[model samples]
Target: MHDTGHNDVSPELDRRLMAAGLRLGRRNLGQTHPNPAVGALVVRHDSDGPIVVGRGWTAPGGRPHAETMALEQAGDAARGATIYTTLEPCAHDGKTPPCTDALIAAGPERVVMAIDDPDPRVSGKGRAALEAAGIVVTDGVLAKEAARDHAGHFSLVQKGRPHVTLKLAVSADGMIGRREGERMMITSKPALTAVQAMRSTSDAVVIGIGTVLIDDPRLTVRLPGLAGLSPLRVVLDPSGRLPLDSRLVTTADKVPVMAVVGPAAPANAKAALIESGVQVVETSDGPNGLNLHEALAALGEAGMTRVLVEGGARVAASLLSEDLLDEIVLFRAPVVVGPDGVRALEGYALSAIERSPRYRQIDAAIVGDDLMRRYWRD
Candidate 1:
């Protein structure tokens, strides 16, 4: 919240650099597991007056941190350069050396970070080390913006689980699909396209076995040029009822797929799914199916910091009832599927929502004929 460095650089310039760094950091977000996707920029002022010498984001798999890459690019230019970073440089040695050590070794004149590291191991130590080395550390340049930019990491550290989003599309009458496991499209092409883009951006997408049995969806990003960015596909199957010939099982070799089954799952079925390249996660069971707490823990262990649950109503209701959802994305369409349609809340539709965790609308937009609303847990 305070600027501690020298007064040579304008606040506007610092913000611009940090903003650019944040954008760069997000480019590889879903791929940077076990580490936050950080962005860094090295700026040097010459006759041109404050030109960026190097810029980099945290690489995939979290190796070669942002600062490491940027400093390497800056080389000798980093001696008197200023650094702008979205999050505090890590100060602890992890799979790689601490980023703060790299910054100190690089001999930057000043270091500006959007926010201090939330992890206790690094928290204030990064700034302390920089100030101790007389590096003119400018802390909290854009604290609020950076907190939002790094929310996935914050959630992972503070909550001990991934940031979970419950996404659903419902008819005007509040129906999700036709009854009897018949899949129905409630939204138009634009909404579907948006869903694909969202899937591409998240670390993984989850769905209940009910969804798989009913829809047989591929759950992959079909959009051209973006197919490669499709996130991991996770299906919650309590009794190991997932069909071996299902699209998810068949495509497990091409993309990552996890079948989260309950304790009572058949050993033969688990072995068969594993043989087909699907990761069989055996977790405890809940009313809807697999115990979501254990299921999410397994996901976080596997490096998913942000996950999307694209569900069949039962799963959505279960997440809401259990207070497991961190965010909600609802698409309200104009069409009605009538009384015979499936309710969005399974055995408990829109009624008794007062019993569920309250949510505050954070954003809303019109996607084709659907009204898309985003909410945060209140």
Candidate 2:
């Protein structure tokens, strides 16, 4: 939607820079799920004009990362180019090499960074590395925008835990489902795409048995070409009640965990699921259903620091009950259904909600007629 046709570095250039920035940001999006949406830009001058040499961003499938891609594209021309990027470059080694090393090796004249990496792994090292190389570096260019794009990932990096998001699709009167147990699509295409985008931005997607039973949804990313790039699928079915034929069980190839309460799932349950090839893990249960704290801890131990909670009221209440939630993201549709139906949070008592997690407002916008607000948990 942004025009990058004009030259002369006018507002148009800024738009193009931003659009390019968005593209670069997108590069690291899927990889940083559980992290933040980060991108990079390289500006080099040639004999003809200010030749923008390379546009490097993070890639899908969570490999190589942004800085690596940027350096690969910049090769040789990086000597005097300015590297414009969203988020602070990483210093610690991860799935790829350190971003700071890549920048240093590229020999850029300057580095214009949008926001600092909140992950303890590279809180300040990337900048330190660049400055140490005697490169002119400007930190925090378009910092707010960078933070807005990667609020969920930033929350995890800063807090040392996943950004807990709570999404509920309700009726005009605020009921989640109908009295007769019928559930319909409450959000439009944009909203659904927004949900899919959230999947693309998170390390894992979580839901309870109720939702699994009702929808049997794939719970995977399905945004055009972005379908295969999705977070790990997680189900909270303490009773091991999820149907074996569910699409989530059949489709997800990643190590899917089913947080259950019993010592072991029933023989029939195991037989049904194993026949379809889905792994199940049983852990201690909470009074509600699943032990959310244990499940979250297990996820973190398994290197999943960020999680999204797509709820069926009871699950939302369970997470809220443990006080383990880091953030809350509620998508309230314009429609409303009256009382006598499922409330947004089903089991928790209003008076019992004592310690509400604190969050900082990041951005609020209308994405194709749907209101989308992002927040960072403190």
Candidate 3:
């Protein structure tokens, strides 16, 4: 904890408290559906210096919000203390009472928010309520970092689209796989594990029907002790041609699977997939195949905030061309796959990606023998 007095927080202390709150907010980032993960901290001052009274993150299922937990833990120590929250306290009631009311009742002397909530019902109302109750309010302390943590929720609420992450593993020469459309390991084990971690953080992992038919990809998180965190597997089988004996179907009972199909899909295929515990969603066909916009909208309606597009080039090109992708996670291997190999982003111009203004590189690192590059839309 950083030292500070009542109503006299320094910039350094503000960053430290806000950073701690943001870290706590990520405890359940991919697990909280229909609600953004939030973190809160309660701090008090004494002759010795400032001390942390309590801290809490949003609960797993969105009930019993962070403020409630922290306030309960703080007890009488909360009076005249400062509360640091990653996002503005929610003012609207859903499964629980308004958090602003709880904060007001706690008799906190000050409330600091990393960023205001974007939900219309709580955007500015939470701060307004705090001020109305005579509690000092601070806004936008490390707002950018808070927004990054809340990206999925914001995308769903503001754009009616789940945050899409496009993952591609290519060789040094930009080839994605070997000839004949076989499943190839472009990156080594560590990079594969990193990709699995990415899968664990998403609500769903998407792939085109071609990938299913050719690669028969399982698309599940293979990491030990974290298999339960594997995201829902989504395959775009517009023609309803997915193989029933595939690994995805065999494990549908263990992990959720959704097949997005076109309206013209054969009833028999759809029924068989449903019989195997697969959730079949029907939408119209786009210029490519499945209407991705409608498919993503349906997912957002299902309360999925984030989805990973682990593709077979075609789906990736479609999502990129249609401007649906929100982020990119690329793995580049050191070896070349030669001219006989499958190229990345088929049917899309490389220059479009090279010169695109909407996306900016956010991070790059070496994962074992492969290099990972991540980008975010501006």
lDDT of 2 by residue, 1-378 (tens): 221122233344444565577666764454554445567777774556456777766665445666567767878888877777777788888776778888888888777777777777787777788888887766655666666566656655554456577765555565676656556667667877888887776777888888888788777787889765677777877767778667887664554544444444576775566566666666775566556666776666555656788877888887776666665655557765666667767765322332334555555777555566554555
Candidate whose TM-score is highest? 3
Instruction: Write down the lDDT of every candidate, Cα atoms only.
Output: 0.86, 0.66, 0.86
* Per-residue lDDT value at 79 in model 2: 82
Off by over 4 Å in 3: 1-6, 349-351
Residue range 166-208, candidate 1, lDDT tens digits: 8888899998988855466899999999999888778899999
TM-score of 1: 0.92
Per-candidate TM vs. native?
A: 0.92, 0.79, 0.95
Off by over 4 Å in 1: 45-49, 180-182, 347-357
**Candidate 2 deviation (Cα RMSD):** 5.7
Candidate rank order under lDDT: 3, 1, 2
- lDDT minimum window of 10 residues, candidate 3: 1-10
Candidate 2's displacement at residue 241, Å, is: 1.5
Cα displacement (angstroms), candidate 2, residue 55, comes to 1.2
